[model samples]
Target: MPILTCSIPLLLDDLTELCIAYLRDSLHASNC
Candidate 1:
């Protein structure tokens, strides 16, 4: 994985941000 090439913390943060954004979009879609 690219995470193996870069810093662990940075990879984790990036993954976390992606998850949060995905969940937010799902919630909005369900509301509509």
Candidate 2:
């Protein structure tokens, strides 16, 4: 249970980072 709790946040953090990166790429594409 404790391991599951710890892994959840790490998974979320990775997902958040991927989302931010995708947003940035889209914004840059729009600017160009």
Candidate 3:
């Protein structure tokens, strides 16, 4: 198996979490 595929999911999950956190932070900031 390739190391790239093994890490791809983790990378994607991290990116998704980052985007979600950024969006949540912006939304909460707007409410304040």
Worst 10 residues of 2 by lDDT: 1-10
**How many residue pairs collide in each prediction?**
0, 0, 0
Runs off by more than 4 Å, candidate 3: 1-11
lDDT of 2 at 7: 43
Worst 10 residues of 1 by lDDT: 1-10
Q: What RMSD does model 2 have?
A: 9.1
Which pairs of residues clash in candidate 3, taking residues 3 or more apart in a chain or in different chains?
none
The local lDDT score (0 to 100) that residue 23 gets in candidate 2 is 69
* lDDT, candidate 3, 1-32, per-residue tens: 23334445666766666666776887899999
lDDT string, candidate 2, 2-21, tens digits: 33454455667766666667
> Each model's C-alpha lDDT?
0.64, 0.65, 0.65
Off by over 4 Å in 1: 1-11
TM for every model, in the order presented, reads 0.62, 0.64, 0.63
Estimate, for each residue in 1-32, the C-alpha lDDT of model 1 and write its tens digit.
43343434555776767666776887899999
